[model samples]
Target: MHRPTPRPLAIAIVAGLLQLPAQAALYAVDPGPYPPAPASGFPAWYQDSHGRTLDLCLTKAVSSRVAGAPGAPAYMCTLLPTPGVFDDTQPIVFPTNFPDEAFWFTADAAIVDAARGINLSFGTAIEAAFAAEEPKAGDQVSFARVRIRVDVPVAGTYTVTHPYGVEVFDVPAGGRRAINMTRDIGIAGAGDFSGALKGDVGPFLRSVNGPYTEGNERFIGDPNLDEPVTGSPFNTNFVRIEGPNGIDLRTTVFSVSGKLSEVNRPTPLIPQRSTYSRHTENGNLRAQQDVFVMAPPAPATVTLSSQTPALALGEANGTGSWYAQSVLNPALPLTLQVTADNSLAIATSTPTTTPMPLTDLVVISRAEYSLGSGQLTLVASSSDETSPPALTARTGNGTLIGNLSGNGAVKALTTGLSPIPPATVQVSSSNGGSDSEPVVLVP
Candidate 1:
C-alpha cells in the first residue's frame, strides 16, 4: 500500500485558544494534462507519468509565443511573498529551479498576482471566450489557472502553483517525444567535462528541462564505481527564470562556470529545506528551491483550540445517501447526538420488528417473533373499547400479520404461521431500504 507521510500531532496546553476557520478545500478539480513537448531544451526534465512538464513550475499562457532566445513575449509567473509586485517596467526574473538549464520560453510577462489578492480577470476573460469552444489535446486551452488561498495574519497567504497543461508541447515549437539522459553513468556521471568549465561551469551548455552535470563533482558511473571529473555542468549555455513569485530567486541567468555562482535569493524568514542536483547543461553552477515560500517547520508548540459551534445535518438525499458532516472545532471532540428532526412525518412504529422467540418451531400466542420467516404475527388482539379481548389463531405456511385494534393491546390468538423449515425474512420499506426481521409459524 502506498502510504502518505504521517503528520505530527499537537498537544494543547490551554483549553480555549483562538482558532482559525477551516483552511483546506473539501473538493478539487484536476489540473488537466501535461505539456506535450519538452521546453526548447532541458530534455532530462520530461513530463512524468502524470503528464506535467518536469520544469512545469513555469507554464506559458495561450497568448504567449515561443521564442528561441530571451526577451520574447510570454506569460511568466511565480509564487512569491504575499502582495508580490508585477511591474511592466522592471526586470523580474521568474526562477525555475533548474537555474543552470536555459529556460525554454523567453518573453514579456504580465502577472496577475495572487499573493496581492488580484482576481484572475485576465485569465478568466481568455477562458470565457474559449469556453464557447473547448480545447482538446492539439488545440490550446487559453484558460490559465490561478492558484489561490486566503490570508490569515499568522499564516500569511498560503501559496500553490497551478501547472497549465493544455497545448504547450510539440507544435512548431513543442516536442513530441521525451528524451532520456544519464541511464548508464546516471543523472550525474564521473569523468565528464574538464578544465575551465570545472572552475565555473558556464560552457558546454544547451536547452532547459534535460539532464546534464558539471564541475569537479563526482558521480556514480557504475553500481560500485564513484569517481570525479572536471567539466561544466553543461556545455556553457544560459537559461532565464520568469515568474511573479515561483522562485524566491533574484538572479536571471546563473552562471555554471563550474565554480558556485551567486544565485541571489530572497531573505525568507522561513528557511529552505531540500537538496539540489549537480545536473546542468553548461557545466555551470546555480541555485534552486523545490517549493515556493513553504511554511516554517511546524511550531514547537501547536495549540488546537476552538469554541463548539452549532452544527446540524442537512437534507438526506435518500437512505442510501452517504450522510456525513464534520463539525471540526479545534477544541472539542464531542460525540454527535443524532435524532430525527420532524419524526411525525415518519412512521411511529417500526414497519417490521423481531420479537422474542417461543418454542423452536411453534410461536407463542402473546409474543412476537421473526422466526427466520418472512412475516410478522400478532400474538393476540384486544376487543372493543368497553369489551374484553377476542382472539383468533393462524397456522401453516400462508398467513398475514395484522395491527392491534381498540386499546391496540395484542394479548393472544393473533399468532401467524411458519413453514416446515422457516427461511430468512427480508423486509423492504416503501423508501426502498431493506432489512431482515424474525418471524415464526406455530401449530
Candidate 2:
C-alpha cells in the first residue's frame, strides 16, 4: 500500500523545532515489526560465517512540497558496511560533510524470504534498542552491529540480502543460522532540493535498504533549478541474489516526493511498503522506510479423488472432485469437477451454487488422450465447467495429436503410429490449486 507524504506545514513545524546549528534530528514515528532476539542467545544463523559484506554506503531523503519553505531535497553520504575496512576500523559516520544538517533516525525492518518460508524475528530487546535511537544518534556510532538470525525448518538454499548487507547460506533439512552486521541507519542523511530553501533548513533524511542490484536507489529533484546536484537521480547501491532456476531476488528501499510510490519492476515476486512523505517537520521531512523481501506463494497441493490404472479409448470415464489445498489461504477450499464429456467446473462454496464458466477462470488444466481399436480419444479439462473444453490436442513436442468432438472425444485419423508414453492428467485451479495422476492406455 502507498502512503502519502505529510503536509508542508507539518514538516516545517517539525523541522523548526528540531533544527540546530550543530545538527538536526528526526524521529521514526512508526517503526514496523522486528525479529526477536533468541532466548538461547544468537544461533548459528545469526553468525556471519561466510564473512559477506556490502561494497557501497549511502542514504537518501526526498520531499513532495518543492515550492515552499519545505522544499524537497536529496541528501547522501559515503560510508562502509563493515568496520576496519576503512580508516581506523570505526563504523561509517552519519551526517558527514553533506552541506545539509545531518541527523540519524531508526525504523522497523521486516525481511522475509517467502520461497523458503523464512520470516525474520528481532525480539523486543532489539526492537526497543532500535527505537531508542530517535531525534538523534545517541550511543550509536559508526560500525554499530545489530544481530539478525533465522531458523530454516525445511531447509534448502536460502539467500537474504539488504542495502546494508547480504547473507547467503545453505541449511540442513532442519537447521538455523545467525549473524551480526551494521545497520544502514548509521550512514543516512537528508537535505532540501526545491532550491527555494538553502542549507539543511527543510531537509528530510531517509534510507532505502534492500538487495536490489539495478536502479535500487533513485532520487529525482526539481528539474527547473540550475546548479542542481550532479547525483540528482541516485541509482545503484543494493545487493542482488540469484536463486535456483534463474529466480532473481532483488531487495531495496524506494522513496518519492508527491505521493508514496512502490519500487516498480517487471514481475515483482513479493510486495513491499515504502517510507515516504510529502510535507516537512520544522522544515525537515523524515520517515522510516521499511524494506520487504518476499517470495512467490508456494504452489497449492492437488489430489485426485480416484485413479484409473487403465482405460479403453472409446469408454466414457467419470472422476470425482480435484481437491486442492492453498498454501496462502487454507480456510477457503477449492474443488475441480470433471463431467463425463470432459467439461471442467470449479466450486469454492460447499453446496456449489452459481458455478462460473472455466473461461472466466482463465486457466487450462490438462490434455488427456486414450487409445482404442485403431482409434484415439482426446479430452481436455479446466477449472471452468460452464464452457466446453477446447477441441484441440497437441503433443509435448508440439506435434498435432487430434481434435475432440462436441462430447470431448477424438478418434485418431492416422494409422500405424507408435505407442506413446502414458499421459498424466492434471488440472490447476485459482490461487495455486493443482492435481495430477498417471493413466495408461490398454489394448
Q: Which candidate is the best by TM-score?
A: 2
**What tens digits encode model 1's per-residue C-alpha lDDT throughout 1-443?**
00010210111111112221111111111232333333112121211111111232223221212232343332332211212322323333432121111221111112233444322110100010011122122222111111111111121112221111111111121111111010000111111111111111111121232222223221111101111211111211212112233422111122111111122211111111211111233664332211111111111110111113423223222111112233231111122222222112112211111111110011233344545553344443221112223332323332434323334323432334445423433322111122233444443
Question: How many pairs in model 2 have backbone atoms within 3 A of each other, for residues 3 or more apart or on separate chains, i.e. clashes?
Answer: 45
Which candidate's lDDT is highest? 2
Report lDDT per candidate: 0.21, 0.25
Instruction: Report the lDDT of model 2 for residue 81.
Output: 24
lDDT of 2 by residue, 1-443 (tens): 01111321111111011212221111111121211221011110110101111111224332232332332233322211222222312323432221111112111233467765444432100111111222222322121122234544454455544323344545445444322222222221121111111111111212322212223443222211211111000121223443444545443322211111221112111112211112234865432211121211112112211123211112111111122221121122232221121112111101111111111121223333345553334333433233233434444444554543444211122222346643543333232323344534556
What TM-score, to 2 decimals, does candidate 2 have? 0.23
TM-score for each of the candidates: 0.14, 0.23
Q: lDDT (0-100) at residue 412 of candidate 2?
A: 22
Candidate RMSDs in Å, in order, are 29.7, 25.7
